[model samples]
Target: MTKFTLYLAMAISLIAGKVSAQDTTFELKVKLIANKIDAITKEEKEALKVEIEEVNKQLEAGTITKAQADEKKLQLAETRSKNIETRVGQAQEELKDLVKQKVDGKLKEDYRRKFSITFWDGGPKDDEGYKKYRDSINNNRSERRTTSQFVFAAGVNNLVTNKAVAGSDYRYWGSHFYEWGFTSNTRLMKNNNLLHLKCGMSVMYNNLRPTDNRYFVTNGSQTNLETAPMNLRDSRFRNVYVTAPVHLEFDFTKTQTNAEGKRLFRSHESVRFGIGGYAGFRVKSKQILKYSEDGHNVTVKEKGGFNTEDFIYGVSTYIGYGETSLYLKYDLNPLFKDNAVKQNNISLGIRFDLN
Candidate 1:
C-alpha cells in the first residue's frame, strides 16, 4: 500500500485497540466517531490542548479537588464524543437515503457526486501518524528551491578598460547605463541545496557620456572621440547586446514554504551570492546627441560600427541580503577596435533577483 494508505490503516488499528473490550459494532462506531472528531479546527485543537494543561495545573495546585478535575475531564470528553456522534448520525442518514435511491435505480450523476464520504472536510485533523506526516511534508517543501523563469536587475553601467581614462570620475549619471535580463535557474548539486546554476538571455545597454561636450563619431571602422557641434546637455554612446549569462549561485538563507507547498520569496532576509560571466554578440550600437539645435531644436542619433567590437564577453559577481544586491561587472574585451585607447566596460549597480 502507499504510505498514506498505510498510515490510515495503522490509525484505524490503534483506535480499534482502544476499544478491545467492546463488541465489534461498538468498535466500528468508535472508529467512525474518532474520524469525525479529528476534523476539528486548529483553534479548537489549541483549545483542547489548553484545557488539558489547565486541568493539570489545577490538580497540582489543589485549586480543585481530584473529583472536580475528574468531572471536568469527563465533561470535555463527553462534549466532543457527542459532537462526533451527531456528525456521524447525519452522515449515516444521508448515506442510507442515497442507498435507498440507488436501490430504486433513481441515482443520477449529480446524486453520485453529492454522496462522497467526507469524514473531515475542513482540513486534515491531527492523528499520531498523520500529524507527523504533515510535518514531514512541510519540511520537505521548505527544502525545495524556488525557481523564477524571469529575473530583472538594473544599476550603473560603465566601461572599465584603460583604467587611466576609464575611471568612475569620467562617468556621469546620464551616461551611466542600466542592465536588465530574464533568466531561469536550475538546481545544481542536488545534495548541496545551496548551489544552483542560472542561465538565461539578457540585454545590456551601456551609455557613455564624455566629461566634455563630446561624442563618438565613426570614420570607417574606427571611432573618434570628438567634440560635438554644440555644448551638449546630454551625449550618450549606447551599445545593445543580446547575451547569455551563466552564474553559480550559493544561497545562505533558510528556505521556507506555505501550506500550499510553494517556496516563499525571502531574498530580503537572506544572504545570496553568485559568480558568473556572460558572452554575446552586439546587436546594435549608436550615439545619441541632445543639444540646442537651431531655434527649432536639434536631436541626432548616429548608428554604425562605432569601432566597437561586434562580439562581447564579460565577468560579473553579485552579493546581497535578500533580493537586492551590489552587482559588479567588467568586460574582458576592449570597447573599441583599432583605437588608441583600449577601454574596457565596467558597471556597478544594484540588482534585484527574483528566485
Candidate 2:
C-alpha cells in the first residue's frame, strides 16, 4: 500500500512541473512581444518628431503657412494611426495563431513592428518634397511671349499750280504729276508709350504742258520790229524721294469690366493722336518737252532744271479710328532755290497696323 502511494505522488509532481514550465515559457514570449512593440513605438515617435521639425522649418522659411502645416500634420497623423493600427492588428492576430499552435509568438509581432517602422521612417522629408511639389504647380501658371509685327504702305502725289518767271515775258505752265511708293514700319516699342520707327523709298513721275497763247512781254517801248505772235514751249518733270520717319506715342486707356460680362480695356483704338517728324532725300529727276514746228508734233530734249539738294524735313500728325489712320505732313523746307520757292509739300494718307 505505501509503494502505491509513493508512485502516485511522483506522477502528480511530474505533471505539476510540466504545467509550470509551459506557463513560464508562455509568459516569457508575451514579455518579449511587449518589448518589441515598445521599441517600435519608440522608433515611430522619434521619426514623427523629426518630421514635425522639418515642417516647422518650412513654415518659418515661408514655404508654407501655419494653416497648411496644420492640415498636413493632421493628414500625416491619420495615416500613421491607420498604419500602426493595421500593423498591430495583424501582429496580434499572428501572435494569437502562434500561441494557439503552442509555438513561439514574440517574433511575429516583432517583425510586424519592424516593417511598420521602416515604412514610416523611409518616407520623404518636408523640404525636398515640397520644393518639387511647388515647382510643378508654378510651371503651369506662366504666360507666353509676345510676337512682333511688320507693316507696309504705298501712295501717290499730284501737282496743282505752276508759276512763271517774272520780267522774262515767258508763259507759265504746270503739270499733273503722280508718285507711287511703299513704306515699312517696324514696331520698336510696345507699351503704354507706343513708339515706332519707319524707313521707306518712293519713285515719282511728272508731266508738264505749256499753253501757246499764255505769254506777255514785260516791255513794249523799244520795238523796232513789227509785232509778232509769241512762241511757247511744253515741258515735263519726274523725280523720286526716299524718306525715314520716327514716332513716339502715348496711350491713355483704362481697364474695366463691361456690362456684357466681359472685361474691356480702353486703348488708342479710336482717334489715336501722335506727333512725329520725317527726313527725306531726293534720288532722281528728269524732264521731257514738246515743240510745234510747221504745224507738226515734235519731241525735244530740254535742260530739265533739277536742283541737287539732298535734304527734306517735315512734321506729321494722325487722327483716325481702329486700323485706319489718317495722317498729314507739312514740309519744313522750301521746294525751290533761295528759300523763295513758294513750294511746300502737303501729304494726306492712310495707314494700317499689322501685328
Top-lDDT structure, candidate number: 1
Alpha carbon deviation, residue 266, candidate 1 (Å): 8.3
- Per-residue accuracy of model 2 over 192-273 as CA lDDT, tens digit each: 2244344444333233233433321223322111222424354444444556655554433333443444433333344455
Residue-level lDDT tens digits of model 1 in 1-355: 3222332333344344531212322222333433433353234556666887899899999899989998998887666545544664464444334323333335444432233223334344445654565456446544655454334344456665446434443454545555555566666655445777788877687777776777777787677777766878777788978799999888776656667766543322467799999999996788878878566566788888877899999898998765546778888999898887677888766564543
Task: Quote each prediction's TM-score.
Answer: 0.55, 0.35
lDDT score of model 1?
0.61
Whole-structure CA lDDT of model 2: 0.43
Candidate 1, run of 10 with poorest lDDT: 19-28
- lDDT (C-alpha, whole model) for all candidates: 0.61, 0.43
lDDT score, residue 290, model 2?
53
